[model samples]
Target chain A: MAHIELKNIRKSFGLVDVIKGVDLEIFSGEFMVFVGPSGCGKSTLLRLMAGLEDITSGEMSFDGTLVNALAPSRRGIAMVFQSYALYPHMTVYENMAFGMQLAKSSKEAIQERVEKAAELLQITPYLSRLPKQLSGGQRQRVAIGRAIVRDPKVFLFDEPLSNLDAALRVATRLEIAKLHHAMNSATMVYVTHDQVEAMTLADRICVLRDGLVEQVGTPLELYENPQSLFVAGFIGSPKMNFLNGEIASKFGANTIGIRSEHIEIADRDGSWKGKVVHSESLGSDSFVYVDIGMSGDPVIVRQEGTRHHNPDDAISIAPIPGKIYRFDAAGKPLKH
Target chain B: MTLDLWTITKRTAFYALVVFIVFVAVFPFYYAILTSFKSGTDLFRVTYWPVSFSWDNYISVLSTGSFPRNLLNSVFVASVTVLAALFLAITASFALSRVRFRGRSLLLMTILAVSMFPQIAVLAGLFEVIRFLGIYNTPWALIFSYTIFTLPFTVWVLTTFMRDLPIEIEEAAIVDGATPWIIIWRVFLPLLWPALVTTGLLAFIAAWNEFLFALTFTSSNATRTVPVAIALLSGGSQYEIPWGNIMAASVIVTVPLVVLVLIFQRKIISGLTAGGVKG
Candidate 1:
């Protein structure tokens, strides 16, 4: 296991800088996720850590050893790529055993490790099939199994689930969480554009924006006390609603953000008045889009159980007091 | 009834064009085989089909003189040249296509430009080098010269084919602790068979049929390849050429190439069309 640290790391392609400067530390045996919008350099940061891309300038160390110049394999890291990147010509068993085979491990050791990994991923039956013959989900499992056979100090995933369909993405996400628990000694750095994945899977989520670390905290820390407005908005699905102008000024701020579930639909004397614009029901819960005349775009309110909030019906909503997050003009949250 | 007639007319025209093209392409080889089976005055007649089924020319070509030796020389030289060219090209193409260097495109262009020059243009210079190396009048000289000419095409085709390979595969290999050599030998070589077969076959054919260099390089009957041997085929006297013996030798020389193409026919077609689209 390795504790990874990046000090003022920067990456550039020609004159265009993708990762300007970033500093972060990931503990040993921790699942650190890099979550951000596209072009935020989340994937690039993971690549730098994995030694797939050389950091233009900075100090990176794994367990107190400088690893900036080390090759990925030499750094003792195995990466699962978004495309699975399985060797098409090799059978599933061969694909998993390849890393160990390259290391010149003994035949018995390689066979044992490959078989164990295949069984762990429930891919034992498909071991003899080529990568092309397996479905996308199976291919990705083989890719993970390949990484597991390496038993590296660190594991890196670059949007490994993004290529799968919606249902498979969820199933594989659960599998990965179980894997993290099983392989508790290995540190993992995962990169994704999906905040839901970050929230559910990460031990600590590192929110990146425009090549900078917006915030790094536990899922509850990020959800409850976001240090910046960007992290508050980026970490949650249905996006945290921002209220500006006169309403925000009353809270002694330039902007105030509140989550959909934090707002309650009131019968009367609500903090904000609006009309129901649309509603979406998901069996257990329903999200009502209320037009509060905040430039026509609706503020979504998450309600438990199904509530028939029909369109064009008058509605009033109020933020649950302390749940509101206040931010200054520069988007940094004001101290409570 | 009218539609049926039109369909028949179009089908007839298509078949007629196909037959004409096939006859035009195959006539010379067909005539050579026909003449090889004829003896004496019967060979002079422009017959569309065989007049006799005689084995005299075949027996003489195989049993007498250094014809069999020359055939062996051609096989040895072509096979070695194809193997050598493919080995060098596969390695060179990995660098040209995968590894980024400052003047890669310029280097590739120079290689292609080298192939553009006529063989005769470099004949004198190559002769000096061949003599300097002291491989003059040997199969090594022919193998060396053929590799020089074939490397450019093989490398160019292999480079394009190698470029289309997913970089992710190579990266995965790297992460698996594969050295560049291992990647080439284990990972890439398997995937590269179609392109290799295609390029190797073309190089084999080129070396097998190459007459100018073979004629200029080797002097002895034992060292001479089939093309030169066929060219230097002697008749009973100085005035009359042994046309039948020459035809029999030509058919013998061409058979191996036909067999090779037939065996790798599918791979060659796929390899030729490889870079044209994603496989």
Candidate 2:
């Protein structure tokens, strides 16, 4: 395992910069994840670390040694592409064994390593089958197994679970968690657009936007104390509701922020009043979209399953005391 | 009842149109085969079939001094041309399809232009070069000439095939630490077998049937390909054509091609359809 450090890394395609200067430190054995919307350059940043792409500008080091000019293989990294890029012509065993064969390993060693990887991935039954013959989940396992056989210092997953169905995605997500546990010493970096995957898999999540790092912290930390509106909106599903209300009467200029789940609904006597514009019930919880008399879009309020609300119903809402976050107009959090 | 009647009429018309097209396409080859079995006089007798079938025409054509040598020369030249063209084309097409180097678009455009050019435009220049190189009357001259005609088409066809291959497979090879060369040979090339066969067979037939350059450049019987040999076959001089011998030689030259087409016709059609429809 090796610590990877990126110093002032930047990427540009012609005149358009995809990854603005960013510095990050990924500790040895950490399962760091980069999460962002499409075209935000999370995958590009991962590719830069894998050496699949040139650095363009900046220094990247592995284990305290500069590896900016090294090839992917020479850098001792294995990447599992989002497409499960298994060799179609080769059997699963051969696909896993390919790197060792290229390195001229002994036949017994190759066979042993391939079988071990297959066992870990629970793909031993598919060792003799071609990639097209396997199911999507099986092909993904083989893609991961191919990486496992290489025994690289780092493992790179570029949205590897995005292609699987929901049930399989959960099952495979668990399998990956178990695999990471089993190979606890190997550093793994994952890139995904799915916030759930990022929240579930990452030891620390790096949220990116427009080629710059928005925030980097533990999933819950980002969820609880997002430094900017981008991270606040990006880290949660149904996205954290944003209302365009200025400090009506600020407690020392602290512009208040509150998550939907933190707001309580009442018939009267609350800090804000709105008409409930929409309601979505998911059995356990419900979301009430309220058209507050504020300047912009409606605010969403997460209500308990028992709370009854309907469209166009007048409602009053207020933050549970001390649950509100205050942020400046620049969108940076301002301590209350 | 109306629907059934409509279906039957449509089916009948379709089959009728198909049969008419087949007859038009196949009658000349059928006539050539029948004529090859006739004697010299029977060829002009205006009969659909020979009164008596004989092997004499086949024997005459096969034994006529330079016919056998010319046939052998054609076989050697066409085979070498197909092999060399396919080999270079496979490598070139893979590079063009998968690599992202500068000038790739320009290179592809150049190949397409070469594929479209009329062979006659390059004939004089090529002829002088071949003569200067002193391979004018040898199989090398025909092989070299065939490459100019066939390589670009082969490359163009194979490049289209290579590009259709999934990019993920190449990425898999790269992550497995396979170099670009290994990825091309081990992964891309094996998956490209059908395309190679299709392109190689097309090149072979084109080289086999080429006449204009072959007739102009090759002087001796030792270097003549089948088309020129069949075209020049006559009774003693230009006064009378040896229809029987000519027909026999034509049938021989075409039989292998017919078999090849029949075997791979489905693949060729599908390949062409995919190339046209997808892009």
Candidate 3:
């Protein structure tokens, strides 16, 4: 419902700055995810946007109106905490109804909104049950339902799926995606350390490191052309293996980078030779860890399914020429 | 066979130790009740039970002595003390436990010091202050005095309970547009029922059994609490100690507290243990 803009926002606890000066703009209805490791200030950035924390310096504008002094409720935002934060003493219905009650909405309106939310969340059967009685997944739904009843301009989720088990997290993640589609007008900002959730849920992922934005781009864009080694290593699982090597040959100043999946594995005839250190088979694809002599690091090559490779096997690998990414010594991406 | 014998001996020793501890803890109260039932001459007779049963002690203690009035006084003081102490302590503890503000640690330390100061150390100064305030012989004097002993412990104990509450619940309320006050009143207070009851009961017992302040402050039957009145009931003239009337009055005063303890014994133990361990 609103585009949120943060201009040079900064925060500090005494002298220790947790959030350095950073600027970001979340367009209307965008599903923006802030992803970083623990203590990297991702959660703090989300909290700052939600008005849960004060912006020490800078301007936060909602829909082009400066809302730096606005209270969280007045800002028309709802946050679902990582803990699910359901009211243990209240039933699911009351938990969802709480915000409307505080806003002094009519009883019929509160009931209508709550029931609609409960139904949308498939939690109608659990409306009368207390939070303690519900399982973690159900409690998460109730927390989401509570946020939905507010019908705010933006929804803030602080690692909302972190507490759920693997299966439940997947289910809840899908539910959130559907919910966003249903409420297409509302802007949503989610923070998570889980890269898969970030990749799957975000319209654009904001990769952060040490209180600074490392890169902000579409998931595939960040994946295919990461600006820095930090983003390169961070965005993927079985993290992209980094091999230290001289340029050997370069076209002008461009430094080449190659991903594991693009490297060709052959029985013989390749640019690089190494003994296979390890191999992981996933049935659909396999990863071959090759120890190139004196490279001081193993290059992980992703091979197509049915490739036969094992540890201690001699192998030849080479980058699929055009697939390599080139970067400068400063880690800036260079044109091919 | 040897292992079985060793295990049997270990079990027997454990039971024996438990019995010994229980007897040591309970025997004094038992002796007090037994002494209260006996006649003055029979009190020193080295007997556990009364030789002759008599309702005369109960009758005299209830009608002719200050025991009845003092029992009523103690009830009023304890009830008022518990109500006021819990009312302020709950709110104060919630603030101390949940809120972030300047001087919060200092405020907590000051409250903790109130509970730590010996009652005897403050007796003379408090007596003068109470007299100067012109509430010396009144229930208000005892009520205020009892708060000194109850509030700090109440706040400290309830703070531990409040801290153990899930922080997310409070944050949920905040996101629901609840101000700090509403969060404390609607969310935190309801969840704190168990802690409140535990603290209130402890405060009541503390106020009810308090003797030094009550004895020093109140001189007349009108305002003297149960303990002082019971101590003063020695045949009305102090020449002969009226053991029977004392015993009957003591039994009357103690029965309610004993029953309360029995009812909430588990909770009391848990609350105390939580305080000790958490602190």
List runs of model 3 lying over 4 Å from the truth.
A247-255, A267-270, A294-297, B1-5, B31-52, B265-279
Worst 10 residues of 2 chain B by lDDT: B270-279
- Tell me model 3's lDDT, rounded to 2 decimals: 0.84
Runs with alpha carbons beyond 4 Å of true place in candidate 2: A246-255, A267-269, A304-307, B1-12, B49-51, B236-238, B266-279
For each candidate, what's the DockQ?
0.38, 0.39, 0.38
Query: After best superposition, candidate 2 residue B140: deviation in angstroms?
Result: 1.0
Q: Candidates 2 and 3: which is better by DockQ?
A: 2
Q: Interface Cα RMSD per model, in Å?
A: 5.2, 6.6, 7.1
lDDT of all the models against the reference?
Answer: 0.91, 0.85, 0.84
Q: How many pairs in model 1 have backbone atoms within 3 A of each other, for residues 3 or more apart or on separate chains, i.e. clashes?
A: 0
- How many angstroms is residue B118 displaced in model 3 relative to the true structure, after the best TM-score fit? 1.7
> In angstroms, how far off is A166's CA in candidate 1?
1.3
Top model by lDDT, which number? 1
True contacts kept of each: 0.35, 0.38, 0.38
lDDT, residue A310, model 3: 71
